[model samples]
Target: MARTPFDAGAEFDRQVRVLTDLGYPELSGLGPERFGALVAPLRARAMAAQESRYEPGAGAGDEGRVPFLLVVSRNVAPIEETMPRTVLHGGRLPGFVDRTFEPGSLERFVATEETLLPDPDAYLLFDIERGEEFCGVVPRDAMKAIAGRDRTLLTIEEGIALVTHFPQVLVKNKCFSLGGSRCGDRRVPAIWISQKAPKLGWCWEGNPHTWLGMASAGTRTGGVA
Candidate 1:
């Protein structure tokens, strides 16, 4: 599981580019330059980690190899607006919310109590796992399993950020759930490959899907965002 360390400064710049390409600036109404400024603290943090001789993704366990997930709050970049910009197949297919998910339907699916939003707009998340090993496990049980590992689930917005920055992670048969956000109902939000593209949808909490594993992260931290 060992690998060459990355240049954190370069990676942060790349992520800024990806966000610009994905229309985060416009979506959040910060425009490009302002949006970049808003997230500057994250860049500094990553660079500081490097100065300390610590690779951004380097930590104690195999899962620590997973780099930080930069998430913009749904409050800032509404999923209703951002989901459509999420593309697959080299931008050929744009993502969609399942028709069953009407406008405002996602509003109720707030982040769980265990989840932390270190910033009003954006923050950094560490130790993310797609939870592929939890495939076929009922989501309610999967939540327990993730907690047993001292992890919390990814929220719908966080899921989108991960897929937006790393689209290759959403391949067929490996999609994941966003159990961190819920509506007090039995539903669990998830993004999956649909019509050869990404689709934001939901699943019954008590049901198990052979293709769906709950995604999670270790914790969150505040940043310039």
Candidate 2:
């Protein structure tokens, strides 16, 4: 895929509008001004940053990936609520939660040791990949591989935010897992295509599906508002 030239400020503003339409301001309790400040650092980076070109031997996870993923922290935009809003196919396709994700299931899943939330309501993830390389790898092994490579896996909130903002990334047969958030059990959360709509479900940690890859990021950053 080609990286089209884009104006970062404009793109950032567009996403902000989309998020605002999603009613994130009320959810974050930041009204509008504080929410803007919460994500200012990300806008600053986006304005000055250029697209990522894979470094030599950087690995398959480096290419065709977004340079930064804007995340509304789970503290404010809870996954249970955000999951249903992960619209795809230009908002024509709706998102769903698997029935298996019963009450209290999401509460058990928190950020892993490596997944840090720098802000109370928002943050940015750099060098995020849908992890096309880790397809067919079980969640257990993929976690080790991500840690070994000095990368961090995407949390459930991050996964939801990614597709919420960049729906084009969640295509059929190429869906990714959220190994960074766990319930201290074998289940790993993921977003995949179901009935032509995106759905949030869980796959066993030891199970490997040819269609499921792990999502990851280079690092995370955010600020206090």
In model 2, pairs of residues that clash are none
What is the C-alpha local distance difference test score of each model? 0.80, 0.78
How do the residues 1-225 of candidate 2 rate in per-residue lDDT, one tens digit apiece? Answer: 654455556666777887888888877788888877777777876555444433322322234377666788778777767777777755576688889988878788888777876665677777788987888998889989999999999988888878887888888778999998888888999999997778989999999999999999897776432
Q: What are the models' TM-scores?
A: 0.89, 0.86
Q: Estimate the lDDT of model 2.
A: 0.78
Q: Each prediction's Cα RMSD?
A: 3.3, 3.8
Q: lDDT at 206 for candidate 1?
A: 94
Candidate 1 lDDT, 1-225, residue by residue in tens: 766566767767877788888788998988988888888788777666457545544532243134666678876788888888787646578898898876677888898788867886888776677788878999999999888988878998888887877776776777899998989899999999998789999999999999998898877777743
Quote the lDDT for 172 in model 2: 72
Poorest lDDT segment (10 consecutive residues) of candidate 1: 56-65
What lDDT does model 1 reach? Answer: 0.80
